[model samples]
Target: GDDDHEGEFGASSGGAFHEGEVAFDEVAQEADDDRDTISLVVVGHVDAGKSTLNGHLLYALGYVDQKVMHRNERDSKVMGKASFAFAWLMDGNSDERERGVTIDVGVNTFATEHRRIQLLDAPGHKDFVPNMISGAAQADAAVLVIDGSTGEFESGFHAGGQTIEHTVLVRSLGVQQLIVAVNKMDNVGYSQERFDEIKKEVGAFVKRAGYRAEDVSFVPVSGFKGENLLERKEEALNKWYCGPTLVELIDRLHPPVRAVDQSMRMVVGDVFKTQGLGLCVAGKLDAGAVRVGDSLVCRPGDVEAVVRSVDKHGKRRRHARAGDSVTLALNGDREELDNVRVGNVLCCPRNPIPMVCSFLAQILTFDIAVPLTIGFQGVMYWQSVNEPVVLNRLLCLVDKQSGEISRKRPRAIGSSSTAIVQVTCQRAVCLERFADYKQLGRFTLREGGSSVAA
Candidate 1:
């Protein structure tokens, strides 16, 4: 009778389970089957209300409780007025709270009408630019927040001109869909003129960063007052606007699609071992697929191993697909697992290549004071790896809009200059061409102790 019932409706009734259990299992299975999880990172200049926007989105989705909000509001008194309730969600450390800024990346999740979103809130301060780079590297889309009232669209000389620099860096890191949130609208009376000015300046910067105008969305909102974030409010205050709310805009973003037929390549993020699971490597699958019985090689020494088991989000599965965070158990000694650190690529043994040494890279310089020349050392950030490398030669610096060399062997590249350079690393590494694999192609050059561009 159980087999007959299951066959009729495609529902499996595990033996010894009650009717209620069967129904619950069926509903849970359906929810798990939905493949619409999207990853987005919120980034902008410091004090741009990035964390506040994230808090509002979570509250609207019913994920953050009223008690937490109350506690945050009370804690705001101890902190500055600018940080109010936002500090709790973004300030994870005591120093960050005291400084009244976000220093590291904070990850939170919320459910929406069409899909589930994993929001990575990155730091906006200039000193914490490295953290922003790391968070942006893992994001599929990005939301750039700007302060409307402060009118701080461009960075001053003292701030290292970080506004345009950060924009260029985020775009080069492969964030396609960008949503520019002109925050603090309440401070400006939600004026249409102010919004337009910000929109125009940001639009110009986005174009200079090599992104099309159509791919960018501009919205006016106050993260502190929770305006234009989740729900619609019919008030004369913002009568001039009739666009989708921020949450709705986020819901409409399609996840970055990866080519399924590409060669098997997955960047290693972490290596862990469970009491019963032996050795496991955890990271998001960038392209292709991996099965339990598939054999792969970890570079730098040509270590080979066979996949003993695969687990995705705590469920044992036969295989894992692209964009899935998976952990693979191996059939070899766990000691060798340390070699597979973050930034290392896992590929087929027959197609093994050196994971280190020098390579030609197309670069963009965000610093004007420093000259990009031969024998100049700068920090290189690609994928999950960040290391110091030397600029071997100034190959050719070309302007993307005109496709011409602005300078040949130019000694210095001002802010927002694109170039193709030859860099030699102290160690071996792996990188994919920008046209082939955008994820591994671009890199950020940090000189003068700051991130220039990617």
Candidate 2:
């Protein structure tokens, strides 16, 4: 009778209900299929209005709850000035809220007219640079916010500016598309000349970092006023500007496409157990595809297991392709899960490689005050692990911009110096060629509890 609804729905009682159900199902399916999600990370120097920009973007997109805004406004009145309201949306911890700054990476999801965005807001202060690296490693693209009014770009000894260092770091992490937001336009009176100057400097720096100048988009806006972000307004300010708004640019930017390879490889990012799901490992599928019931060898650990299930976004899937953030459940005992923790590789049994104890890496220094020398102890961050490491030897000092070796075994590499060095970690860790896997290859060195660079 239900099947007959398609033939004569106007005749029978069950026919009308069946026809309505089918229509509802089709509409729901279309809605589910229409979604396009892109993951982006927002990063910049401290007090660059990163949190403010994130708040305004969400507010304009109708993603900010009205009650939250009301509470913020009421609190601002009590505090005697308008504090950062959007900071609350990202930094939920009370310590972060009281400090009025972000320390760790904060993730939030928002939907726009064009697509859905999973945004990672990273801390901008120098002290939290490690957290920034962690967030950028998982992002597809980045939004670098700069304060237009201060124009304080160069923090260390480099002539270009700190934004230059930030750009190079983001590029090294494999972020192809970049959106440069020159915030605090209201403080600068929305001057086209100022915006152009910052844009030019930043564009040149981006180019120097091995990124195409055309790949960078510049948007001048006042995050506090919510100007030139999601909506376009015809005003006396910024009359010379004619370009896509921040939200427009974000929607227009496409996700970074991964090149598929037949070789089987996957870098583990984290290991956890979900409710009702035991011993799940999450990470991007770097190459090849894995289906449920396929056998995989946990490299370095030398453990073997059958993929009981592949869960993605709460749905059990038959297989996972490259670039998918998948969770693979094991068909064996849970204790073996520790063997596949972050930094472990997943591959076939025949192609296992040993995790290296020491490696040579080209490193650039961020803090110039402290000279990087041989046997300098600092924290090393790669993938999700941050541990103490010693810089065993400075093989050669290289020029930052030219990429030419300046000296062999220099006594010390100062700020703005790039050098190739042999570094030994406190423990064995997995690392791939930077060209092969940028996510796992790149690392940040920290000294005196401050991040220098990768």
TM-score of each: 0.82, 0.77
lDDT per residue as tens, model 2, 1-454: 0000011111110101223212212221111324455668899877788888898778877878899988877775665536577666667677776778899888777766776677889888777777788778777789999888844544421453345556667776778789999988888778888888888877887776667666789998878888888765637454688788888888887755442443456777678876755677877675556766666778767777667666655466656665566778765545776566776778755544347889999887764577888888888877556878898888998865577888998998887667899999877776776655555567888777556767
Rate residue 61 of model 1 by lDDT. Answer: 72
Clashing pairs in 1: 355-428, 355-429, 356-428, 356-429, 357-428
lDDT of each: 0.71, 0.71
lDDT value, candidate 2, whole model = 0.71
Best by TM-score: 1
